[model samples]
Target: MKVSKEQSDANRAALVKAASKLFREKGIDGVGVAEISKEAGLTHGALYAHFPSKSALAAEALALGLELANKKLYGKSADEAPDLDAFLDYYLSTRQRDNLGGHCAMAASASEIGRQDEDVSASFTEGYLEMVRAFENHVAQARPELDSSSRGLALVAALIGGVAMARATQKSNPALSKKVLQGMRELVDEAGGLGKK
Candidate 1:
């Protein structure tokens, strides 16, 4: 029996979504084609039909993860924050840090993308740039007078780095996570204050 177009699309989507989550949680090298197929409840051969190879799937999955992260981090408008304090609090909360299921894909996988082939690296690069754009948008809205891509890039780097560090030390030193997050909060606050001049 031949599958309808809708069915085919849904099957492919399943592989994409499953692979995205696996890529974030397990890294590109950590997950295999068979594992992705199994998670999606499709036969391993079905994966090849949808994605040219695991490398292609890695690219797609990275995009999917970053898209989800964008939605989660920047989904709110400036109206949501009464001040920068609230904004930073919501931005670096443990809820976003610990929940890979709904967090940014770049946070979960960018560090490891360097290990993948060129195709995978390109996907990560594109995704990382997009994430930076999203961050720039938020920073602009938060402080319109002081706009600079360099500042935005630094903020994104600090946010990603802080969150990652917080997670890494959470098991051994829970206080370290909060300290790292608080340090970033102060940095953004100081920058915002300086922008007023």
Candidate 2:
């Protein structure tokens, strides 16, 4: 009847991973603790042992999702700047739009974060600022003439909004979804001065 520290850590990680994927696929409000526990191959009681409440688990899960996405976009090291063109292409692609459970947390849960607890909101804000800082560094290098901070914020907003809109219209209006992605990509390209000398 007792668990090792290693096993406990592994279990907690599993719970977070499962919760992150499920929350992205179905909104946070839509998932129950039992389902998350079941998905993680743990008991409902085990979930409580790791996290005080579902909201606590949700906050950790959201942080994990955002961290993973940032790593994917920016690479393992902070010194590495992402290629804006490649980032735009992948982010606005139908592939990312359709992969609900495996994309950025911001776009997946943007509509629901406003209703979540302060901890969840703080996690979202931290993740978002981390992304903006990385983007700001990249923009500063690429276009020193531009206000990197403002451009970074604008790029992130457009990227998150574009993906969310594309996903919302994907099933009911595929054409419009594609157009939305295209328009966002064009906007980013223009803003970043991608095609210019």
lDDT of each: 0.74, 0.89
lDDT of 2 by residue, 32-86 (tens): 9999999999999999999999999999999999999888778767676666566
- Which pairs clash in the backbone of model 1? none
* Ten residues in sequence with the least summed lDDT for candidate 1: 78-87
- Per-candidate clashes come to 0, 0
Candidate 2, residue 18: how far the Cα is off, in Å: 0.3
Q: List TM-score per model, in order.
A: 0.82, 0.94
Query: lDDT (0-100) at residue 30 of candidate 2?
Result: 95
Please name the candidate that would achieve the greatest TM-score relative to the true structure. 2
- Pairs with steric clashes in candidate 2: none
Deviation (Å) of 164 in candidate 2: 0.4
Scored by lDDT, model 1 comes in at 0.74
How far off is model 2, as Cα RMSD? 1.6
Per-residue lDDT tens digits for candidate 1, residues 1-197, read: 78899999999999999999887777788888889999999998999988888888888888788766655545556344233344467667877777765566776775887788898888777766765675566567767777756667777677777778877877799888878877877776676442222
